[model samples]
Target: MRELAKVQGCLDRARGGLGAVLVVSGEAGIGKSRLLREAARHASDSGFAVHVGAAEQMTQTRPFGPWLDALEITPSSRDEDLRSVAVLLRAAILASAGELGSATHVVIEDLVDLVERLAAEVPRMIVIEDLQWADDATVLTARAVARSAAHLRVLLVVSHRTGGLPAIGRRLRRELLDLDVATDLPLAELDHAAAQGLAEELAGDAMWPAVHPQVEAARGNPLLIELLVAAGGRSGEGDLRCALREHVRDRTWALGDDGIRTLQYAALLGQRFSPDLLAEVLGRPPVEVASALQRAIEQQLLISSGHDLAFRHDLIRDTLGEELPQAVRASMHATIGRTLARTGARSPEIARHAALGAPRGDREALELLRRAAVEYRRLAPAVTVDLLTRAESLADERLPDQVELELLWALAATGRTGSCIERAERRLQDQPQPATAAAVHACLGLIRQRTNDLDGARTEFDTAVALAAEAGQIPAAYLADAAST
Candidate 1:
């Protein structure tokens, strides 16, 4: 929320032309309001007349609730009579800055229509906060108004959480394509030094050591940090489960199914996930998924990194994971793995899910491990080593002989290349199946010959030639010529 550079940049842009729409998005309690409050102060100091309107969840459905609140109006009277209140609200804004007949800056906090209407009058900085819970009507109206403010000296700044407000964000972006500026501020996790400093700032010196892990665990989210500090002043975990549960419960009811699904799937992915992968996992269209992702990014539930995205707080992922049934999670993982496989892409992540989702004796599990081993062999050398290690551990004793040889091939191609000679030699010693053993020795011979192990290479080649004669295969004969070098 306190991305000073972004706020200042918007201010500068607004000063030059029709106001700028600065969308401040992050997760809940990420200091969105605090940042706006500071920007308001800065705007005031710079001699810009500023009026603020904040959008609260309760009054989102009622048109201009935050706008009405900012002006200290009770809409109870208007609701009873069904009177048009737009004129009155406009009059009030004009009275605040217009009556003075001076260069005024209007800061409309929550709703966009009020800001859009005021844009016609003068240079203004309109800040709409808590947009994640904004009413659909309010969002649509704001989007229309935001688009019209291009020629006016108005800076529209809206803040919402990324996960909670997908539908509204989607509508807003499609309708107001040109004027919208989306800014995602992923709060930086506190480093040791910063954690100690924050601890000292909130609680005195002695508390730093006690609270370091909690701060680290919270991932330096200012809102979470403040909440944790206020709860116990740098003590123990201090009801992390209770706090997290309450946090989710507080926000979940307001968001629709898309929000819930995005959060749950992201939780399964650990912290960060690829956008394409997330879309595939959800089985949603790219545009729709992207819109949801952008909304989540804006709300602070997720952050973007080039093409990948992640949860704003690690605790969010942890909490969602803990709350779900194991079976449900396994099902989701299976969907994710199959989706990835269809695209001809493989990941350790997919393997993990496939491993968990497939039944113990299931052929799908066997195939997933085999595919994972081969893919790991092709893509990630270090990761292949880890996956192969896990696969070998889980592999049944009755695994086919060829499967064992494939595992050896993967091992040789990955981190344990030094063990290749021993492994291949042992497999050959066991079966001495000429052509197959020759193939293994041929690979070993190539590697040995490359490393200048001439004697070892000679022995491997001689064995391969003898195997070629015994096997009487055209392929083995060719391999014999290649291995004999």
Candidate 2:
């Protein structure tokens, strides 16, 4: 709101003689678009004409897609008069000036060059959204235009997510500093009253009954608020899944079977995946995968992060995951695991999926799970717990009891020390097997050591070492360390 006031001040100054540039940024789903829409509405009421355009996430490589969105021009027209259209837009701005309805106000949601060019032509307010996702070319063009034509009577506003900004955005910030027309907008979180008001906007008088939990779940993502409210009280988890699937299907239906296959391959890898990995797993060329990903991005179902791609929503991932038969999902998981392993990825996430989804209880699956458990112990404790829990649930009697003990040991190795120790002690009490009891005591001893209870640690270590000795196995070094301490 402060930035808007400053921009409006610039616009007001432009009526006499001045220019402005506003740089606003926040995290993804942080209401950049919603806020821009509201600002555009205000501009319109204040007598400025508004035109909005957005850049597609998947087509950063494609030039002028965002410009075309704002202009609503077809491919045929774009080819015929690209520069001529710019001149025409310039003429429109000049002709639109002076009269109350004469000046044009434009919001180019994701492109900066398109607005920068138009700003050079006339006195107008121009807004650009999501400059972070912009291609290098767009960034370069916008910077050049902004630098060369700062004297123009225009107010330029641009917004983006603060994290994951490409290098171009950082450079632009430094460049804009030289212009002395920059205004940074920092967003504040919605307070309780404001959050309730937003919910009421979506659900009417009884909004809280439907919107409170989603508001909590969304944690202030405005786009998520829309999806959650539309999904209706969150009971439509399945419906939301189907809706996302249909959204993707409708957008990609025009592409032939190859495109559909590419999407299915990506879906099998799950959400937030690398396009390069998906290409490898599917045995398709990278170019082919890139093309399919581009098309999906144009349709807005897939969002891009450099070389990686992901479904725009968790619902989309769930939808695609559920569509495949159990056998197919298992097969794909196995294939992905093997491909990742061969490429030296060392990704525990892939291994966990393979262990849980692969139908064949091959030894590879077990090794993958064990390795995943070890890696997750350091990088992600909850994931380590999940991997071990899955492996234990699926392991057959053919598995050695020691393997089960190892899984339990991993679980206790990476978690809230108190919780894991309590669970381990309870489980050991039931089984009372020497290997399991020793593993449980070893874990408890480690937890006690971490908490600085040397006396308790020594007692648990003594019990573990005695049990291990009775079972004809050496106690682990960690237990020995606790004992010495």
Candidate 3:
């Protein structure tokens, strides 16, 4: 394929006695693993020694897991050199003698030496998949190999997701970027023509106008496209969601209850979440939350970005969210809202959780929505209208008249004058307190002005002013300022 050409170039460079490194990066199911396989085939055909190792998302706790896989060294291996290196590497990782730091150095040096030996015998190509889930020691060893490969007939191909790389992965990527011997090959989605070709190949003569929509929906993701074609282009929302869930099941199912719960909370928090906020929502200790996050990072399910962690793909988060029962999701949202409230979070953030989490007629949610509306009134009138509208829907007859006034004002501010007039007329029928009555009249006056009814607007404004003057000083001043406009 076109993508294989670039990888084949790296293999060619290695064969020419020039060491090369190719880092293939893409989102999930974007063919990174497949590309590595293609590179391996090309290398093997060119009489190069090919070693492939894949990092396991669930088994990252095993140090040097991918390296061991690549070396294929057992305690009873027939190859003496391989056995010797594996033994040393195991000791280095385990630090059985309690000399961890020095052992790690030995491990890196031995790995570099092993690569040089392999390259000296024959051009060697090593492919490490899912480096994003590699442990710290494994990452360091790979980095060491990459640096030493510059002068040897070695080609190193490392693949990882583009997002959600842990700190070690990020540092390794940055170092590779700075190295002259390395090439960064970021795979983009296929173009319309290429995607259509893939669809046709998968579906054969049955492919038609229906395949066009599937390709469009697949958004150039090869795996998604393949799935769509396999499903006969009947990939509905539920089907797509189910597909995504299964795609990441291996990474998630291995997690403990705490880890699963951590993921659930993180999904509820949004695409990116802080450990502190997550801990607060779960009512767990920060240390406990951190451990779960570490596991997620190791599994490649979450990428640590500074102080926060994000799902490797938005689809992963969406899939998890869709699987959550409505009651549990709403309860979690309410818990998150309460936690955020304690942190003095902004109104919109707090209101979002509160509105979703709180059931119908929940006073706390209604209050939070009103507060959010007030915060958004000037900054974002549309948001203000939305929050107030939700609050209006949730408010009971015993709800304060101020909420209705705020809703009316927010609706009018958004130029939704018709709705504002209707709400104001309903509020007036309830005979609200004088101060709230004045606010409603002022809101109606604004709506009348927007409708080009100058006389009606003037009359409403006059009535508002009269009611405000009788109510109190604050009401009179507020209405007076409103009437002048």
Candidate 4:
């Protein structure tokens, strides 16, 4: 309620031509979206033009996805300057994926232009939710929009998890606050009184004492409080996660075979997904998928989110996904990964499925991970290391282990030479065969040289050439060129 008041204050300021950026951040199930929606409703009621959108983990590879969601009703302006905005929107819709380039900057600039132009016409509130999963381009655009919103007649609101933000997302938060043009709203756990009151409201009775134990168990998370209270006479259960899973299963049991199968399969897609996309993955008609999803809606398991359906809470989807047996989960992940690949989803999104779904030593999965690592190398430092690490775990002791070399390079590039050295030693111990070890040494030498350890690097390079010649592999000199990457 206090956060809502603060956000509403920003709206009032925007109405007076003094807009500001508000960054809302909190842990999972902490009512961040709920608060945002409440403020948005208030703005709408007060005659402020409002637009809303959110990002999802499954579609993080799509460019400007959240902006696309927020501006759903855009591009109808007959103003000549707005034509470029419409053109950019159409291009984004047509392109399934995008790389880091000047074209992306054009789109971001046009988007800011559109917002500034429209705000000049009327006061506005633009809220982008779940920014933690936003693609690189979306995060960049958020920065641009925030800078423009500082003095325009538009209040820009963005929410992300307390710890899940990408590098750019964090930077935006810090930069705006440092400039004194933004408000940081970090929502902590609710106090006892508020938690008990929320429990009483959810239960619709005047009995906070009866629900006090549930409140304590949920630790002030609104979603968990509701779940625990609705769990129906299971107050004695201690293992909340297991109990919650069983509760979900009990609810889904009535959905019958088709509905249960649909939910389990959809869980692999992400926190939010379009029924049309799910249908394609299942190789079923849209109507069939609709029927199953409709059943979920009836069960209060999934809620409509624009053109997509999202599980009522992330835990529900995660529970269903975890309920699958190990082999079944892996098979489903494999199926989803392969289907996404054949259907032209970008590497970053597909690589997640490949890492979880593909069988051991699946070279195709490794290749996908490698490509994804390359895509993220310059864009996101953390993701590059993560993807390459996953690839290395799946790689066998092949002579030319590109996964290992790439992982070391990424670790080194990110100033993580300690990890680089450790992993290189492990590679040498595990895959000491001439071709692989020689490559690892060559890569380590390059890192050492970068760090200005000239004598040490020279020694390592000499050892690499000797190993290459001993194995009769690619020319010893070639190892330097190959591994330097």
Residue-by-residue lDDT tens digits, candidate 2, 405-464: 555555555546766677777677676777668867887877787789989988988998
The candidate, 1 or 2, that scores higher on TM-score is 1
Candidate 2's C-alpha lDDT? 0.63
Top-down lDDT ranking: 3, 4, 2, 1
Q: Candidate 3: where is the Cα deviation over 4 Å?
A: 1-28, 40-221, 224-232, 253-256, 272-312, 396-399, 431-442, 445-475
lDDT of each: 0.63, 0.63, 0.79, 0.78
Worst 10 residues of 3 by lDDT: 476-485
Tell me the tens digit of each residue's lDDT in model 1 across 1-485.
34788777777766676466776665577666777889888776755557666677566555555445443445444442112354454555467653412211222333344454554455577666776666554465466557656766677666766455556665674454454443444444456677657755875566655655567766656767765665555334656566766776565544467777777887887687887777777878778788666655654566777778887678777777777788888777777777767776656766777766655555665677666766665566556556655565656654455555555555555536577677776777778567777667766766667688899877877776677677885545445434343
Cα deviation of 220, candidate 3, in Å: 5.9
Winning candidate number (TM-score):
3
Between candidates 1 and 4, the one scoring higher on lDDT is: 4
Off by over 4 Å in 2: 1-3, 47-54, 57-122, 132-141, 148-150, 161-170, 186-197, 204-207, 233-235, 242-355, 360-485
Q: Report the number of the highest-lDDT candidate.
A: 3
Q: Would you estimate the TM-scores of all the predictions?
A: 0.56, 0.50, 0.66, 0.49
lDDT at position 461, candidate 3: 81
lDDT over C-alpha atoms for residue 169 of model 2: 71
